[model samples]
Target chain A: MAVPRELRQISDAVWELPVSWKPGMRVPARLYGTRDLVEHFDDGVFEQAANVATLPGIQKYSFCMPDGHWGYGFPIGGVAAFDPDEGVISPGGIGFDINCGMRLVATNLTCGEVEPHLHRLVDRLFERIPSGVGSTGFVKLDEDEFLDVVEQGSRWCLRNGYALPEDLELTEEQGCMEGADAAKVSHKAVQRGHNQIGTLGSGNHYLEVQVARKENIFNPGLARAFGITMPDQVVVMYHCGSRGFGHQVATDYLHVLLDVMERVYGIRIIDKELACAPFRSPQGQDYFSAMKCAVNMSFANRQVILHRVREVFSDVFGKSPDDLGIRQVYDVTHNTAKLEEHVIDGRRRRVLIHRKGSTRAFGPGMEGIPERYKPFGQPVIIGGSMETGSYLLAGVESGDQTFYSTAHGSGRVMSRHSARKKYQGKKLVREMQFRGIYVRTASLRGLAEEAGGAYKDIDAVARASELAGISTPVAKLTPIGNIKG
Target chain B: MPYTYLEEIAIADVAFEARADTREALFVEAGDALMNVMVEDLKSVRPLVRRSFHAQAEDLERLLFEYLQQFIFFKDAEQLLLRVSKVAITQETGVLGLTAEAAGEKIDPSRHDLNADVKAVTLHRFRVRNEPAGLIATVVLDI
Candidate 1:
């Protein structure tokens, strides 16, 4: 497909593809990217974004963050909100990873303090947090217990001694989502999730220890307010999602919606990847319920992982997590559909917001934010590729342009197979080592696939997003050591 | 013929890549390798019913993704062990294509050694490239 000639440049970092450019589109498509990045888009991304624009009740614009790329129904970094009454909910929009997201934990430990024990710390994390595919953690739960996780999320972790109440205060949505009905989830999904809590499921899921790089700190005042002191202060960041439970829920619902799309809804899709059912339909409700369960399950998973990390640190350093000043900076879900109130058509209305490969960057004073951080705005945790620098950002008022959403990560630039064909794990490891970054993976193949060169430049993407006012940079974190699943 | 497995970071280095000759064969081969990475032999179920499907994508890559997603859907939702039998593709345009196919069985716990469920086929590093020997595609599935 040729680049649509009607795409008008709104600014240095934004472009608008008018709804008239594509048939069936209900709204325009807004893309946040540099001139170079906009030109790099392939036909699939444009089509996917356009497809999103055509959805029944999408509002304002189908927005894509700087890291946008081709995805099933919506491009990665896509954000759209729909009227609860008229809009349709597509499982493809939330993605199978469910609440695949990132969490940042601030620590009092400086880089100098952790550098000496970086190897030991990573090894301990690798041991405590089971990684790789099919890796199970020590946590075990029965059906009812798992239901508690589904319904209560991080609160379940707190009750189970996996987390503290304070952690919940710092987590987005308070570490749980409402409307979770475990009964809606299949037995298989529950079974799959029972043993997987605290485990890092493979493929892009990882834990990293990072230090703030000097130059990328644009807001020193905000950083100081957030307790980010020295440039070498060490922090822990990890990204994962609801394990098998989320996969099963998405799988189960895709088929249900497929049947609904054909039999009851009378909707014909151009792509099965766009499988959906009317929001008011039985199948849609069931999926929404089950998906919430998966979302909560992810919160529980991350909570348990946090507990284990604390344990590892305590055991190794002979200090409690609190004594070490380890506390959750923030936890944010990237893939999810949630009910939110936004101004639509000059009036505030409740809508269902689906953000896939995107994060909610609610500005300060939003009622949904936790009290402690309400004045500062929501913390946005952006995970870059292993070799790139990740960032900690704060939501800004300017995000109203994008329904308060931002890109989730440094989007991929190359396919994994291509990376494997072009590079060797050993050689890549050596190169990372030369850059002063240490990486440990379950397989050499996994390491090569996550090579830094395989992803877009994180600095560029972060800058573009910040410049667009979707998210404001708070701190810049450069990885020193990491473990990948 | 047994399909070979190759891992690549194809699109933008965001996803994993797996390839096979036949559509069903590719799915089964990819399934085996993907499950193997997570656990062990998960496709040991006996061939049951042959289910036919017709999936359309804006392009071949999306078609292949829907193809793999269908197998995952069957395996997770219907508890069916689906092994692709045939795959036919007609490319209508640069990013549009139609795929038709048939798959093998119902999943039997006694026979099928189920492993990690694949969440979705991501476009992170997704690609489908034609080679002199055969057609090759790479996908990064969120498992």
Candidate 2:
């Protein structure tokens, strides 16, 4: 597909689409990427971004990051903010996997030490971590108890001995978002999620063991602050979300909002997935409260996974997690809409920013990050395909341009069906294993669809973010072992 | 099977168009497309257990959306890998209702060649259209 004809190039790293491109667009749409990246973007991405610009009360410009791709209502890696009183909340902006995010953990082990035990560790983690389709977590909760899990989030994990006190501090929103009312969540949501706390869902979700090579460390001081001290320090990173629970929450609200959006609020949407309700209206508030429940559920899910990861490390090395220096670096969400204060036209105003496939990269001295690392800004984890390396970045001061939002991952450039036809899963696994990366997966066909070549260059995306000043590179982590579901 | 995957529609998700001479057959093919998306081989999912359910909406588009969403719900909430074995659609004035009987067993990843977890059936250009000789529907499933 060719790039849209009317896209205006603002800079080598930024492009703008005027409101005149679409009838209902209330603001101009901006895209952050290199010319090559933006040019290769699917036409659907542009349509989705333009459609988002039409939402009522949308402030400034609607934006899509370098990793942006086609999505339901907004392009993946979309970022937009709206006035809390006048704007709206749409489940489309948050995505089906509510609070889908990345969590990184640091360990004192080195690559050489882990190399010999790599296969065993991967197998054990695969067995212990519940992966693949329809996999259930070890955590069991009845409907009544499940409500508490959604309400308390990682705090529930802490009480259940799955997390430490410091883990909460290192987490975005301190692991438990406020005003999450379980009562607002549906029974179906609880049933789908109650037993899925720690299970990694299938389709691009993965758990990997990575090494931080010295040559890849761009900012040693900030890297050390995020726990990359040794020359080839080993770390664990996993990507997942609230499981069936979050999907159900998003599904329920999308239908509910769609039923009343036009009849009640008179809000028209270009896409059915973009159905929304006014922020202050009863439907919107209910959705917000319910959305937080999914957010909290996902936070708790990752915390339990972190605990399982620590246990796996401890069991492999025959030492306690604390003895092995296993600690959480940071856990941050990508799919969420949260109320935040940002300066607009020289005045600080509170707005609800809906970041679909984008990360919150709060710069130095920002209020949301942990105080211990506030001087260096929040740690941003950018996960690449298992075949490629991932990066650890920091929020930059200039990120105020997009309200401190940055790309989430190396976005897809090819369709899964096409990728599957181009590469066989078994062959891809063999190739990756030969290159020093051990692999474990639930399905070979699923793995084939995730070949590194299917996505854009991660280096280019990171470089674009830096040039755009939305983020700053800190360190790069090379994968050694991977477990996918 | 009277369904084909639309690779170009939803790059990050899965989209398919199902067609049949009748609405019931169209619904069946649509569910098959959804089931096939989750499991690579539809035959890999044995009809060892049967489930009966109902989905009602005011329109055919919403009806299709509600009907296909049930597969995601079954997999997530009940861990069932089902295929629509029987379906009945009824129109009562402005309201439309669908009752379906599906069969499959609890998903065993080892036995089923799992492809991707279909997160939800999205409404991105979702539709059911009527033609002179048949009906056609387009559906997208978020993976």
Which predicted model would earn the best DockQ? 2
- For candidate 2, lDDT tens digit of each residue in B1-143? 59999877888778999999988888899999999988888988999999987989988888888888888888888899999978999989889989999999999877888888888888888888898858999888888
Residue-level lDDT tens digits of model 1 in B66-91: 66666645543444555554566665
The lDDT per prediction is 0.77, 0.91
Pick out the ten consecutive residues of candidate 2 chain A with the lowest summed lDDT.
A188-197
After superposition on all CA atoms, what RMSD does each candidate show versus the true structure?
7.0, 1.2
Give the C-alpha miss distance for residue A295 in model 2, angstroms.
0.5
Q: What shift in Å separates residue A439 of candidate 2 from its native position after superposition?
A: 0.6
> What TM-score, computed on C-alpha atoms, does each candidate reach?
0.84, 0.98
Highest-lDDT candidate: 2
Interface RMSD of 1: 6.6
On TM-score, the candidate that comes out on top is 2
Could you list the iRMS of every candidate?
6.6, 0.9
